[model samples]
Target: MKNKKFFSAEHKKYLRKTRLNRLLISLGRWSVLLFIIGLWELSAQLALIDPYITSSPSRVAKTIIAWAKDGSLWLHSWTTLYETLIAFAISIGLGSLLAILLYLFTPVRKIFEPYLVVLNSLPKIALGPLLIVWVGAGTKAIVLMGILICIIITTMSMLQSFVAIPQEKILLLKTLGANRFQVLFKLILPHAIPDFISVLKINVGMAWVGTIMGEYLVSQAGLGYLINYGGLVFNLDTVMSGIVVLCILASLMYFSVATLEHYIHKKRNL
Candidate 1:
């Protein structure tokens, strides 16, 4: 009974520590958010900048809430999120496959490496007009644009991770009678998981960028469409609201990737 009581006390202490830590982290994050919004509100009130162009935090918040009540904001957010998720899935699936192929085949890598580099460096906005022309105006074109923006980066990052596995490890696997296919699947892909997560984090932003750019040129829905419409009509509050929503969505995606990265690293270390 004494030992049981001691164990219970220890568990309670651990729970308390975890709660405290979570609270501290939340406070830090919220403090930064509040500080930025406070500064923006103060600046606008002081007339330090034109509120018409720059907009205040309060105005942006009101605009978002207003759009939300009208269903426009939620609908647009859903459309963009759907397109982004679909593109992200395609990018990760195809990019990782291509990376593995290139990693395994010297001839394939030699032929495609330069083109991959060029494609990665190319401005995705340049493809906007062409994508709309080919895929038509709407979610499909936006998803395609996002996929193109992300695939090259994911390929390059995952390929680098695959090659980064130590040669000694490969040698050891070969001595164990593992064939090329077995070695790649059993060794390289597992080793590349952390890098792949990192690549996904990057692809999230690229996907957003591509989707937004595509919307600017095409599409009748999305936060990007809202921003374009806002600018055309000089509705600064609407534009600022769209920008805020984009920031929040991107940050959330990045945070999710970071959590996955942490989990992968912890498992690896253990």
Candidate 2:
């Protein structure tokens, strides 16, 4: 009974220490954020910087609140999110299919590799005018931009990982009577899982970049449009609010991808 009580006490102490560490970490992160905002606000108030241009955190917060009350901001945010998700999904699906095709056919892979490298090298924003002419404005253009950004990156990343599988492993599989399909599924695909996760993580940010750039170039709606409108009208607060919202959204998407990466890593370890 005494030993049991001692073990219970030790477990409680460990839990307390873990809770304290978590609280400290959270506080440290928030403290740094608050310090930066406070410094910005102070600079603006002291006339050391142009508040009209730079804006302050409090002003941005108020602007967000006003937009939230009106419902326009949420609508724009949703439009951007929808376009990004659609493009990301299409890119990942098509890229995976294309990667498999490349793996299956040596001639096809050779023909496509140069094209992919050249396309990836080209400035994505430069295609804005052509895309607008081809696909028109609004969601379609944005979705196309996102797809263009992701497809090449995903294809290249996954293709490299697919081909990087050890030759000895492939030989072993073949000797064991595993055919092309079996080798692909059991060997190449499993080896490419981590790379696929990495591509997903990268595309989360790249997709957002493409979506916003498309919107900035030509869009009737979305956070990009809001920021452009704010800039035109000199509504610094509105611009700052849009900036904050974008940061939050991008961070959330990044965190989601990171969580997925962690899950895959853990699963693979097991």
Candidate 3:
């Protein structure tokens, strides 16, 4: 039989209201986007702004369609996406491992902590010249750039999460004769799941920034290359199209993280 006791009428009413609110909010967001696009297009048609410079939505769409027909759209997008994904994965894996090590060893943390801060503060763009010279103008340089941008932030954030775990819990585990590795894997890591997810979300944008910046410096392929080429050749429409595609890509990545978060929450609730 259904659990009638748990299904209160007020709870059902609240759920319906929440769903309706969410729908309205989503509609409002799209409405605002369409309104702005419409205004922009209308202004361009009326000669209120230079469409050549600003690149209206229609022009961007046309540019994208042309790229699609030429079959370069996916090629460029995939190139950037590949670099970003690889960098993202490496940064997460390496950063998390490093963070755990730092948390486990106070001396190591003390020695490297200041350097991490310095590296994070350093403008990654400034290292492009050095990276190019070191790694050459290749995908390796691009991936390295992305890793440099993301790794320190991931390490710091995750280390903080590890440090923030309840001291009492660790003490309890130790008192119960649980080893360091057991405590880390069974307790610390589990508790830090939300922090790890947050790091992934933050790293998504960082990875994109790193990839595009690297592309700007060295890439012959990718959306960043297209944007740079278009700007140099005075093709504002192509530049805007590249930017729109990047925004779409970033949004998709962010939503994927959000979906993972939702799944995790659902599992926890269950």
TM-score of each: 0.87, 0.90, 0.94
lDDT of 2: 0.89
lDDT of 2 at 11: 90
lDDT of each: 0.88, 0.89, 0.95
- TM-score for predicted model 2 compared with the true structure: 0.90
141-206 per-residue lDDT for model 1 (tens digits):
888888998898899999889888999999999999999999988998887777777788888888
For TM-score, the strongest prediction is 3
Instruction: Name the runs in model 1 displaced over 4 angstroms.
Output: 1-29
Candidate 1, which ten residues in sequence have the lowest lDDT sum? 1-10
lDDT of 3 at 51: 98
Q: Number of clashing residue pairs in every model? A: 0, 0, 0
C-alpha root-mean-square deviation, candidate 3: 2.0
Clashing pairs in 1: none
- Maximum-lDDT candidate: 3
What is the model-wide C-alpha lDDT for candidate 1? 0.88
